[model samples]
Target chain A: MAAAEAAFELPPPTAEEEQWRYGPINDFEIESYEPSVASPGPIQVPTEGPSGAAALEAASAVVTVADGWVVNIEVSADAAALGLTIQAGLNEPRTGFGEDADRFDRLHEAFAPPTLCISMRDGAELETPVVIRSHHTGQGRACFPHAVVETGEDAGLDVVEYQTSTSGKGFAAPVVQLSAGAASRLRYVVVQELGEGIVQLGRILCNVGSQATATAAMAAFGGSYARVRTDTRLVGRGATGNLIAIYYADQNQVHDFRTYQHHDAPDTQSDLMFKGAADDNAGSIYTGLIHIHPDGRGSNAHQTNRNIKLSDAAWAWSVPNLEIENNEVRCSHASTVSPIDLDQQFYLHSRGVPPAVADRLIVSGFFGEVVDRFPGVGIQDEIRRLVAEKLDRRGANQ
Target chain B: MTELVITDLSVSVGGNEILRGVSLTVRSGEVHALMGPNGSGKSTLSHVLLGKPGYEVTGGSVSLDGVDVLTMPTWERAKAGLFLGMQYPTEVPGVSLLDMLGASFAASGIDASGLSDRLSEEAERIGFGQKFLSRPLNVDLSGGEMKRNETLQLGVLKPKIAILDELDSGLDVDALRLVSRRVEAATEEDGLGVLVITHYNRLLTELHPDRVHVLADGRIVAEGGAEMAEKLEETGYAEYASAKPAATAESRFASGGFDA
Candidate 1:
């Protein structure tokens, strides 16, 4: 627990950093946010699994964080039998954990309660996944949480974390870190569906070692102001990383996402794709960067962001940047932000699908591409169901 | 008799006339072949009949079985038993052909939940595979597939009138033969009225038209028996283009002739 306290005292981020740009630092004033001690509050985790939870659970280690404490953590028995360990604190000063680690350090430092540390034993191939649920209840209360996962030599692990709120103006700040060992494979999924009045900040950092593979899936569907930042660093040769993100914002909500792909090793590859849809005065922003160091030879990276604006008032912005100091590198980025195709709508309507139903179908289909990529069927279904519910609620409110 | 009546229709887009003073009658159990050159208003007339947006009826009346259709919306026109096989049908991503056909069948008042199965049977009869049912609606479909899918929709909906626009534009001999067979079946089995707009006489050879009309410069310059189709095909619409003056009114009638 002392190591956890040290993880919180790291230095703060300055405003001039490139990563901190477009972030709402004013809204995250730690001074204004009242700090409350960790409590063993009544845990209300969804037993039946929210539509997509089953699939998510099958792909990763599962943990449930209610209010401000860990309510449930289900490590797969196979993983446990293979010598997986759950540790609370491994407080070490590293480049990503120290002061000025990144913009995500703020969330990590501010929300230090209910922290989790998971370590995979060497050469263990756990087939079943681990799932974690972070839930918030009551009005005006906020929850801060952190989860860290480390895989040893030739180890494989899958982790799923779900963040949800039960009524009231709930808020959450979650930070996730993944460390991959040589020849290790890891898959992670982070899902966010908080209350409308809630605000959320989610951060994910990954370090890929030699011959390691990593994949991350993110779905953000709720919160008034939800921001997510994902950073992946390839530290050794023959490392590969894939990052995918999907979000749906409606009714005056705002969604922001920042992603970084850092290649420091030779023969490394990274791919990123993010898609979003906005409707009814909602807004979305996606900013991503791919950086290749001088020693990162034969590195390849690609990034794409696509957005659909369902209404005239809805808006989306996408910015992709690449900085390559290495000549033997391949990197490309593409983005598109546009309204729904009228011809598509007409074609659907001509077939007797009411305009609204057709719109929903199209939107769902658009998001399905990303959701289906999730490693778990339960998580896919949960995201689908949540999207459907959101669409229904939006329709009713309209 | 069930019929579609077009009375002195003048249709315009952006204040410029495209279908000017055109009148025709298509009765059930008969196939009318409308032959014309490019930009001769055949597609425009079809769009006007279907009540597509952006095409205003400056003057005209269109009726289906004595029910006025000119004032109806596009979907209402479709519900009134009028089907326009678009020249360039739009692609709807992620919407399967079977689902679309089922919805259309239901909207047209057909009672059945297994419409997809029924459609598959019909499609198989036309030499299309059951796998086509799962394909996205017209997305990445070949021209022949698109034409056959249109026929499938018609078979399912069984509308009183169908206006097939350039149905033979991009088809091989086998596809053309299949399409002609489908049209013949619709007219013979259901006593459905059909208006086939084309520039060739090959399709008319397979499915003989009861009547032929030559459209030139936004008006029908000549009308005759099915032989007229062959004549126009041979002459390439040159005779019709030369026979009519460019700016003539063609006819003048208070409410019924080929004049608005």
Candidate 2:
């Protein structure tokens, strides 16, 4: 409980820093929202709460957290027999996060609450996913939670984490640390669907080991101001890391994303694609870099960021950079920010599709490409439904 | 019983007067051929009718069945039974042809029950396989395939008046014949009024329009029967221009000849 007060005394991240650009550091004032208790009492888990998103329904384990407190944990007996472990918090102090650490990282460290860790043993193969659902209730209450996940050598697993915020003002800050072992495969999805009055800041650090493959997919749709910074480190030879995201921001909301793809070893590969749409007065910002160190010879990395503005007042900014020190490496980054394609509008309009309907179809079709790439996640249809609902809400407000 | 009537229609693009006082009419069940050489405002007329951006209507009146269409939006005009088979179709990335057919058919007030069978029948009628309906709209389609796709939309949409802009240009002989036959068939089956804009007489021969009007310097300079098109093919627009009186009056000319 004393740690929560001490964490607030720490200074916030300054806007001038390179990593702070377009971040919600200025929008977050912890004093405005009530901070969650350091130690919360056991919660009465609601039987019929926010549930059954296909991604969560297909999981073998479900962990539900209420206001930074873990109240429920469920794991299948079959998965338990395979040496899958779900525990609370790290057993030892961690190290090795240097340049990626910042003031936000320090703040989360000082106020870290009940931590949830999901790990799989060596050679374990899971056919179903493990889901973590975090619920933020209470008006103006602040919550800080930490999560850690690890995949053992030669093992494969899928994990999904979704955040849901109830009505009223609040703040949520969550930090996640994840890694894949040698020759392992890990697919992780984090979906942010907060309520309208909340502001969220989340940081994720992922490490891919030798000959391993890792994919981190995120879908962000809620929050008054939402920002995420993701860093992926290819630490071992021949590792592959893929980062993909799809976001839709409507109304007066703002979404920011900063990603780093670091290739530290030889023959590693990384690819990233982030696509989003901003409507009404909503705005989005994306800045990413592909960094290849001297030892990352023969590495290939590509970064692409695309955004579509759905209204006259909506805005989007995309900045993609590359830092390659190895002459043998191949790395490139590209970005595009524009309103819906005029050609697409004309084609639909010529067919007698009204202006609004035409824009809706084109926007849906535009985001469909990104969502279709993740059919394995089984959340594409749900994402589409949310987009339609958001568009309708925007229409009604206009 | 719908009629497309244009009176003293003038348009300008980027402050340049491309179309000056153009007037023509096409009633349902009738086909009118509009011919002109390069820079003669034939395409401009089509765009202005569709109210495409960047083209200002300096002076004009366009009506469909006596309803003023000049103030209507492009989509409303389309729903009001006006269709333009564009000379250059735009490529859209992710929208499939089936999705387009469903939305477009509904816009035209068609009952969309069993839309699959209707889309298949329309694709087949245009010499396109049913699988083509699953493909994205005009993306990576060859020039011939794009033309066929345009005609396919015209057939299913069943517009009262279709302004086919240079359907013969940039098309191979086979594609040109196929597009021509499809438009002709659609006209007969849907009771469509056709306004075919072209510079070549090849399509004019196949179309055999009820009326042929030659546009020059943004105005119709000659008006006559189908043979007028064949005569212009022989003399070309250069000789046709000098043969005319060069007057801006609303003068009517005799068939196969101009009053200079």
Candidate 3:
């Protein structure tokens, strides 16, 4: 453990930086939190625990991590026969984060516990998903959960990482690194539904190989001030990367997303879609960039960000940028921030739908398109339920 | 029997009067055709009746079954049995027809015990396949298909009165015939009163009207039996065009209407 003075000595990312412009950085005092210890066993939670969602029953394996430490792991008989190796307490030093790495990244690298690793052999295929439930608890505590998922050549796998926190003034920083081998298919999802008193800064890094397809999906609906930055690199020829995220922020919460889609090789492809809504006095910010390097000939990349504001006090910011150096590549980026459409409300109302119900339907439908594109199954219903719950709370507050 | 009454209705949009002293009534089991040339407040009247915002009811009274309608909200007007078949059905992405039907049913206090089956039956009658019910409401639907969807809603909602504004504008002859026959069926089976707003008489011959009224310069200029539709069709609304208020032309264009 580091000295208390040393923990406060490290600098935090400031609001002036491009990636942290819309973030509430000035209010985050690093001295207010200290590292939390790992539990010896699975932490006992109440019926309304921080992680209320049942372990995806269809999962081939279920793993639980608490306070940045792996607490439990269960592998199904079918998965064990198929030789799916999921082990904890594997320490891998973090490296190669590039120039964008900031103080938070270093802090996470220094403080996070042993990495939980899930590995698959060449040409191996898992029919069901492996779920990881990462929970954060304790007041004024900081926890960093690190995970690394890898698949061999021509292998197929699905992994889900669920992040949650008990209600308290805590800090969480989680990192996940995914490496998809050549000719492999890797699907990964991370859902963040933290408590209202927590502040979370997370990152998802993906590296796609030749002829491989990698998809990353996320649904964020919690946290007082939550921020996630995702970077996907298509480093091999003919590789494909798809990114999708849907976020809803209620109360005074703030949800921030920064995404980068990098096409570094020829014949690569990437498509990204992020849709979010802000209700009550909540706010959302999305900034995305699609970059095609000089050698990325024949590559195609598209980035789109859409947001809806459900109240006069709610706000949203969307910025999409493109950097294309290859003349032969095709790249496009678009962003939009608007309120629920009036014409749609009028249309519903004329059909005997009340105004409140019409707005609810519109908001629900706005996110429905994104929900349909999600690749996972067991968690899709949870996303819908959370969105509806948020809407119900908004109704009650009104 | 239900009755929808309009008394000396005057309305303005952006401080410019679009409807002036209009009076009309349609009782259950009656069909009334409201004929007018372009920019003659036909669409405006329909919008006002369904309580669409942005239109100021300067001096008017609209009541349904002896209850004041103008004082109620748009959904309340719909719940009070007023339906408007829009000329350009708004495209609402991500909202399915089935979802809309469920919400409407609940708002109108109608039982939705078997909404899916009822919707499937009504959709099939109008050639709107069952698959279409799960698709976004009116998104990418053909013009004829949108009209059919509207007609399907008319059949399902069974409102006491319906104001169909240019229901045949984007329809082909066969689609017009199909939609008209469906409307006639609703009128016959449920005593559904209708105020058909149109620029042409093509729809009149399909569902013959009990009374035909001509609107010129926001006022009802002529009212007669069904033969009046035939006479107006031959004359082509030329006299009515000549009588349009000169001062209203500029305001109409500013309000998004084509030049008369």
Score each candidate by Cα lDDT. Answer: 0.77, 0.81, 0.85
- The per-residue C-alpha lDDT of model 3 at residue B243 equals 54
Stretches > 4 Å off in candidate 1: A1-32, A48-61, A90-104, A326-330, B105-112, B242-260
Question: Every model's Cα RMSD, please?
Answer: 4.1, 3.6, 3.5
> Which candidate number would show the highest TM-score if scored against the true structure?
3
Give the candidate number with the greatest lDDT: 3
Chain A TM-scores in order:
0.88, 0.93, 0.95
Ranked candidates (lDDT, high to low): 3, 2, 1
Candidate 3: segments with Cα more than 4 A from true spot: A1-10, A37-41, A45-55, B242-260
lDDT of 3 by residue, B137-242 (tens): 8998888888888988888888999999889988898878878988988899999999999878899999779998888767676788999999998997877654
lDDT of 2 at A345: 82
Ranking of predictions according to DockQ? 3, 2, 1
- lDDT per residue, candidate 3, A1-398, as tens digits? 46333444556778998989887878987668887765636775332433435546678898888888888899898886776788877657466377666778877877878888888778888988898888787578888888888889999889987788778888988888999999999999887888899898888899999999999999999999999899999999999999999999988999999999999999999999999999889999999889999989999999989999988999998989889998998888888899999889999999999999998899999998888777765567777887888899988887
TM-score of chain A of 2: 0.93
Give iRMSD, candidate 2: 1.4
